[model samples]
Target: MPTISMTVNGKSVSGEAEGRTLLVSFLREELGLTGTHVGCDTSQCGACIVHVDGQSVKACTMFAAEAEGAQVTTIEGMANPDGSLGVIQQAFQDNHGLQCGFCTPGMVMTAADLLKNNPNPSEKEVREYLEGNLCRCTGYHNIVKSILAAAATMRGEQVAAE
Candidate 1:
């Protein structure tokens, strides 16, 4: 076993990981940050999405040892310092973006990445950006709306009432 160290959610942390230990496992089992769900062991689902070095990466596809010295941000980190939901999260709740909520964390993380790159994404663009994430719940109408609203909020623009 190797001791892997990384900056997780703006905090420094280290844990033991086997060479085969997935980053998702390390995050959930070792770090106890279970917000990053393990929907599929394969990379087909984006439920284990997390930000590594400021880029969204599928935690299940990466080894914990590979995240050494990296800066990782899990869904648990996507909140205000006071524990309130972050902008994207709040938008999700406000727009009813979730149903079973199984995919909400991944959707939110992907939206964050998309917004960071394209602060104002079109409806089609949001749909395209979310291709990797899947939700067996709603038709994604409200999910798209939530991302758009979050984008507007992040841009300091007023979110028009639906």
Candidate 2:
């Protein structure tokens, strides 16, 4: 095993990893950040999505060693400093964006990335952005609504109008 260090969730963390270790395993197994799920062993499912140096990447696709000295933000890090749910998360809850909860982390991570790039995405754009994430539950209606609502709220507009 080799030592790897990275800044995760605003904290400095170090761990041991084999050359073949994936970032997802390091986060969940070594660092105990289980919020980053492994819904699909393949990278097709975005359940293991995380922000790597401020850009979203599927953790299963990246080796742990590749993340050396990088900044990683998991779902656990998406909260306010005081530990309350962040605006996007709150929007998901308010709009009923989750059922079974298996896909919420991925959906939320993708939504965060989309909102980061486009503050006010159209409904079509929202639907398109979510194409990579498969939610067996909710049929994606409320997830789309939640993303739109979160975008409106992030833009300081009244969420009710959206």
User: Pick by TM-score: which candidate is best?
Assistant: 1
Residue-wise C-alpha lDDT for candidate 2, range 49-151, written one tens digit per residue: 9999988889999999999999999999999999999998999999999988888988899999999999989999999988888888899999999999999
Which 10 successive residues of model 2 have the least lDDT summed? 153-162
- RMSD over all Cα atoms, model 1: 0.7
Please report, in order, the local distance difference test score of every candidate based on alpha carbons: 0.95, 0.92
List per-candidate RMSD values in Å. Answer: 0.7, 1.3
Measure candidate 2: CA RMSD: 1.3
lDDT of 1: 0.95
Which predicted model would earn the best lDDT?
Answer: 1
Per-candidate TM-scores read 0.98, 0.96
Distance from true position, residue 21, model 1, in Å? 0.3
| Pairs in clash, predicted candidate 2 | none
